[model samples]
Target: MPNAIEFLFDVGSPTAYLAWHRLQGIVARTGAALIPVPILLGGVFKATGGSPPGTVAAKGRWMNEDMQRWAARDGVVLAMNPYFPINTLTMMRVLAGLEGDSRFGGVVNTLFAGMWQQGLNMADTQVLTGVLTAGGHDAHGLLALAQSPDVKARLIANTEAAVALGVFGAPTCFVAGQMHFGQDRLDWVEAAAAG
Candidate 1:
């Protein structure tokens, strides 16, 4: 994937959501493919003794303002979900299950928008159903797939692999084996791709 960016993400991360959208523009500009790597952020934190920046109250407020600045600068919509730090076990399982499906990208976009753009609580079973159904997916089927042992295993493996790669948080990108964290480092990612 020298010509691609392995995008490690969690559906619950607003920064990763912003990074995802900017990476789309990077794909267009650099012609570098985005290899999506869905993982559980909670697992990463547990394994690495790391935590999201929002864990501290003042840091959380500052980070909110910072996130808003990034979103506005990137010209993407981002409203902080009132329910921050949601349990995304089921949601990430669904993403991992969609790995090879043709609808994966659309589904990812829908889920990201549902969480960040519209500021919906994606952890809610009913809200998720409405989002998926409105996004043209058979909600019941996807939910069923998420419960499969294989899908659950895949997410765990991905999370472990991420930890192995020194990935301490969401939106970690690898370009030619160089790791860059955060959405603000997208220029370096683009430069790595162009190389």
Candidate 2:
């Protein structure tokens, strides 16, 4: 896994979605493999006693505006989810279940695109199923798999692993053990990957 970029993220994070797009460019440029580690932002927050900047009214407004600017700068479409602060427990479990399966990336793309690009309220089971079906997946099967014991454990472990790596937020990247936090830190991430 040397020269690999470990992207610790959650689909619920707008910046994580942006970093998800930007990191691929670095992967293509550096010939470094991208490893996605799906973790729960709420779990991270609970563990770290760290609150998202958007929790405060002023910070919420500023972060929303800033996120839009970053999206425009990166040529990525970012429609803020109408159902912000979604409970991603089930979604993350589905992702964890899909890990190592060929369907993982597609599902990740589906969920992130659904949540961040299309402004879909993924909290609704009906909407979630429709989104996955549109993405060419067996929605019910995936959701069933998510309910299994092992998949739930994997998500918890991933969050713990992220915390152990000192990740307080989503969009964290580590190249050769060097930590680069935030979507805006792509430069340092690329440099470390190249190094």
For model 2, name the residue pairs that clash.
Answer: none
The residue pairs that clash in candidate 1, if any, are none
- Please give the CA lDDT of all the candidate structures: 0.92, 0.90
lDDT of each residue in 1-195, candidate 1, tens digit only: 337888999989999999999998899988888899899999999999998898898999999999999999989999999998888888899999999788888989989989998888899999998999999988999999999999999999999999999999998999999999998899999999877
Global CA lDDT computed for model 2: 0.90
Reference-based lDDT, residue 180, model 1: 97
Top of the candidates by TM-score: 1
Give candidate 2 regions above 4 Å deviation. none
**What is the Å distance of residue 141 in model 1 from its true position?**
0.9
lDDT, residue 183, model 1: 89
Quote the lDDT for 175 in model 1.
93
lDDT for model 1 comes to 0.92
